[model samples]
Target: GRISEGSGEDPYLGSAIAKAMVKGYQGKDLKNEFTMMATVKHLALYGAVEAGRDYNSVDMSKVKMYNQYLPPYQAAVDAGVGSAMTSFNDIDGIPATGNKWLITDLLRKQWGFKGFVVSDYTSVNEMTAHGLGDLQAVSAQAINAGLDMDMVGEGFLTTLKKSVQEGKVTEEAITIACRRILTAKHQLGLFDDPYKYSDTSRPKKDILTAENRAAARKIATQSFVLLKNENNVLPLKKDAKIALVGPLANDKNNMLGTWAPTGDPQLSIPVLEGLKNVAPKAKITYAKGANITNDPELASRANVFGLRVDIDKRSPDAMIAEALRNSKDADVIVAVVGEASEFAGEAASRTEISIPQSQKKLINALAETGKPVVLVLFSGRPLTIAEEFNLPINILQVWNPGVEAGNAIADVLFGDYNPSGKLTASWPRNVGQIPIYHSMKNTGRPAPAHQFEKFKSNYLDSELSPLFPFGYGLSYTTFEYSAIAVDKKKIAQDEVINISFTVKNTGDHDGEEVVQLYLKDEVRSITPPKRQLKGFKKIFLKKGESQRVTIPLSANDLKFYNSELKFVAEPGKFIVFVGGNSNAEMS
Candidate 1:
């Protein structure tokens, strides 16, 4: 759920990934007909949405913006992303769609970004709600602010012409907006032939091919994080009797996840269907143990695009009873649970991101049967799963595993594939701790003995640590990392330090391990994070096989935006950690 599963979420984000995405989307030449222009979005801080709500306002310092958030947008711009979409939130006093300082000054003049700026869906019209202006006034303001295109709202199309005629908007701003649009069209080779994407013959060879589905299944395994596999309850026996129970057990509509308007739900194989196909010998009993939610309104919201999650006619108590009844005679209880696709992405943000109470009831009932519980969780964001930890269960986080959701999940559960995926973000202990992250800043007075330290930054109810940290994931096989060895502790300003570590597969099976490298600047001009992830490696290892991974850390890696907003790396001792996850060890 933490990973950006097939959405506009991670199109342009982090440090170098944004640049890589631009190249991947646009290819070598933007003018090439085959290449598509990528729209790098939000302009700034969409991920840091307040309370994790969609289109919520964000307030952060300039230093934090430049160091933490601004680089990705800058990178996408520098990488030549064809279009930049404005964020829904206001920057300073003006909405992003009408912020001339953001679009004209910072983006165009300062960064030398040549691409046209576009508004997010109905963002221009929504500006009136932001207390900016009515549609006609806001549209003219947006054009004056350097926005070349309006997405889905006809605000600019309807108002810009009249604003120009009335002298409310300058002819030059309109001309520039028009010129940029035409330039983008020409660069995309769309001006030559606008209806190229309307071709009828492309689907037979390219879309939904055997090779594509195979790759989807493979990547699905890679994105999975085995949260808890207590007693090795997973790697489920192919010959055992398993009860597959829950709303998501055989739902096709939820497989492709959110923002996939063109996806065909009928083509997706549900978990039950995949298990049957994967383990033909396994005795599988299936039941719609519980609806996604007890509330009909929530179900209606979730099924906006299609009925991914539906409210059952039967009562919750009856459904839970049925699930328990089904699991009584089974070797193991496999509960398919968690968020439906609509619960995430765009306006799909949740106030409570946890396993639905209805599904949780079913899961708890099944677990009470004294049978091993294997939970397959589906989500698009980090959910508060602390309640589930009290029970004996094996948790696998499979975030919207695309069209091959069933086959991929079947493969993992039955040991056809070993999960090698690591979490990209940290999971909080509870929903109240929504803003938690791995690289959080250390306090002047840190937690005293990880307990209540009065007059400190410690929480009264929750702990300082997260339930699961960034880059955390388990394997069917185990991995061990030896001590870290650096080429030299002290180096010249331009020199690089070579860090090396040995990782060995100490378990029975051959599997992949994501070896992470983290560092903490002991003292800095500004108080840095407790630890920042500098580098990582995903390597394959056979049983008892060891591999040495060497990562080169340049002085540039230690640099940060100072209080003066100048990027510099201060000379100081740094604590380096390297191991399986973000909570790496040196001792």
Candidate 2:
């Protein structure tokens, strides 16, 4: 459910997923009676939550928001999502629910999003928490902000009428809101047939149908990231004996991860099932190496949501012994480990973003077997996998890839599909560096690579760098990036600069690459990130084939808010860098 609602962190991946989801929910014909409303959620910067916690406040510069967070939402809007959900966080001291600039001036007037804006559950009421105003005042403010519907909270229905009568809001505002609602209802053909999507027959036949499952499987496989592929150990010999270790080896419940409302854990095909289906002749042995959580309290909490976390019934040493015994004679050991279903998603925040100690111990013991270890990670959020990078194992980050996750992992491991998905969020080495992103503000004295000071803008314990930067992903095939060339080095006030580059697939296999474009405001009234992502393009290419990708930059892309909070694009020498990821650069 979380995967379907919002784009998972990466703008490129999110854009692709958004397009697919919108197409899946609402067919080519917008007037279809059975069409489901695809809502682009949290409009902006909701994913940049402090400490990765839900309902946390977000404070960001307008340039950062526009250059980073708003693009994916804009991509979704461009894909024609039926509706939008306003976030709970505040932007520049104004609650997103009542931010007129964000809702009206930006989304509606600027972006041309005709769909109505619905507040997150009780978000309109939560305006009081955001120090906006009282219920009546806030509701009026939100309505005037271009919010059309209030979800779950009767804020709009209850206070809008009173606000309009009291002169705090105009009747025209209510009519506009109602008109957007009615227009969406009209587009969905809801008035023509109110009972269209409500049919009991379609739910049985269409929901999680074979075709839908196939699509999910294909998408999930593509989403997997093959982090390491040492000595070409993958695509295990079909007839060789394989050992699948860890508690999640055959567990179906953990395969779906979190926020999967309609996902049936029992019906899910676990990694064991997928491997068995792909290589029926191979001897695949499994063992419950360790529980997901050693803490009984956490296990009990996880069990509340019907997740299995076998609370340490046996001693840790015994479990490790059993796992090591299982892996000793196997040609390859696939360590299926990571967080369970309740570890992430709304309110499921974590302080330490790493595999649990108990599971890590099991992995270490399995690694001692000297066999090639293939790590299949099941997670929701980006985890700190720096230590795993040094291990003599091949790791594939399969982020809780829905119901067919097991099958998807198997497909990628066995060369059915080459992993192409990249990291959407930066993986911080430690939890102290909360709210860290690639597009962070510059300080008066930035920390230089060689210069280290106590009061410097960095952590004393850990390096001032993300374990895995945003847009970081590895494919089975390799690609070579040539120097970027711009059509014009300098541009007039309204003139556009065409930046082009050549990306050649230098490997043997065909794969996709996310070409990234970043811009740096060398001179600006307000500070900006060292480099901010401005544009990106995903392209597929065959081996030895080169594609010339071009992206245009306008005055708007170079703009920043001044001291008076006015947006202006200062004319100066701007450094344009084009590459594959946050670290990749082309001068």
Candidate 3:
């Protein structure tokens, strides 16, 4: 479920988001009143946990790490991120919190990162469980490895002095770590005023203003991805009778999703309320079609933080019966369904990445209503909806929209805004394809296209394709790509190649399209993924309007980390692919 928190299965996209996130947090100046410092965390392959389980060991080659997993952290460093946090998992048989090769050698020296390093919650202390040593030894190891602060563990506060006195850790190393931390504090203007951000009066004046909510509403709309829209069932009529039924339809508590403990749930607008606000004329009835999950144990786990998964007093049959009863008199059924907010954050990993069986039953029943059914799916991560995809219903992935959840959803459903959010990750067909991604290498016995070949890299029960590919999203308006032109077919290592392509909005409504660029290396010292994302531009096109979008392919875009661990671009013929998504045709 950590995929929900990242840029998803590609290093290039991850790098772009990393830089943008740093810029957004740090702003132009470190001492800016409106800006705060950013911390790039996990410092290693934390997401690629074994068996897709949290806190599990991660093992992969250095080549894979440099070419795939390490670029985003490096990008964050280049963007001037202020602090770095160590991962709980070990790298090369040493816990990341105590791994000098990762923190001191690679991150600080090689990547030129000047930021202070901190450990994840109790991570330095937890290294003892990793068989490194006792609390004193692990704390000494962490300080030696360039870790500055120990969050919540107090390992540094209790043991670092003793370790330094005993000569286990050098005094100079501890001093350097302390200096780095103090430097960060000074940069944040904390020395001048220790309570700079803690003024009680600021909360009422600066937080959740009308303008702030309006901005939140707009941003939330842009984050939604339209996964599937069969027959354009969306842009629902203003006066249509809508049976708004689902566990989340009127619930505000889960609107903010996981990892947002500070947000006020009461302030969030529910889907039922948002619809009324957006389309007063639309006759919308509401019902709790099903609980997030019928299983008591699952609901208990989700409720660890709060009552996010509220099991109803009514029976499942009674709930679905009421939903059916409500839909009988409605022209359309808009079912809001997905995992509870607690289903996808830290310590939240599932073997089956699908909608809960309880909600699935409600969805199937709603589809049988013979009315136009639209699913407003809410989840922090991509869900396996293979069975639901085959249904004759439109699907919109809302992704646990924040404080303005209802209003943002209402805007997209009523065509006030066309969803322009493209997925940063791929949606798998089933749990069997757990680690499925777009940039997978084709093995020696590559599977032939559009066919089933024995002894090939193919699945007998499923296609090797994701249910929805990376960069995939649909707009109410359709687009057509053409006129792909390049300034030159060939370029030197120092030269820039200009590629331009025309995109036309062919549908009746105006919408935004994310024009993506992918590159394929014909030859390299190491094997490359079939394609890698090079660049992308989001452009708005009015009905019947065409725009020629150009993005540069720089010399650095062609380079990759070789077996010798050097960044180099091998001479070869390269293929360029430009389209709406990653599964684009060659240009």
- Which residue ranges in model 1 land beyond 4 Å of their true spot? 1-13, 31-33, 165-168
- Sorted on lDDT, highest at the top, how do the candidates line up? 3, 1, 2
Candidate 1 clash total?
Answer: 0
* Candidate 1 lDDT (Cα, 0 to 1): 0.84
Task: State the weakest 10-residue window (summed lDDT) of model 1.
Answer: 4-13
Query: Which digits, one per residue and each the tens of the lDDT, describe model 2 over residues 163-216?
Result: 877899999988998999999888878789887767778778887899999999
| Clashing residue pair totals per candidate (backbone < 3 A) | 0, 0, 0
- TM-score per model over all chains: 0.95, 0.86, 0.99
Candidates ranked by TM-score = 3, 1, 2
* Residue pairs in candidate 3 whose N, alpha carbon or C atoms collide under 3 angstroms: none
Candidate 1: tens digits of C-alpha lDDT, residues 1-587: 22353222221126567888889889998766567899888786666667766777877787877777787788888888889999998777688888898899989998899988999989999999998878999998888888889999999879878998999898898788889999988877787888876778888888889999999999898889999999998799899999999889989989998888788989998999999999999998888889888888888887888787778788888888877777778999899998889888777867777898888888778777888999999998888898897788999999899999999999999998999888777888987776777777877777775679789888899887788888889999999999679999897779999999899999998899988888889898888887887887789999999999998899888888899988898899898899887788772
**Model 3 regions more than 4 Å off:** none
Which portions of model 2 show Cα errors greater than 4 Å? Answer: 1-29, 60-67, 71-82, 91-94, 98-114, 127-146, 155-176, 441-444, 450-456, 483-488, 491-510, 539-569
After the best TM-score superposition of candidate 1, give how far the Cα of residue 145 lies from its true spot, in angstroms.
2.0
lDDT of 2: 0.80
What are the C-alpha RMSDs, in order, of all predicted structures? 2.3, 3.6, 1.0
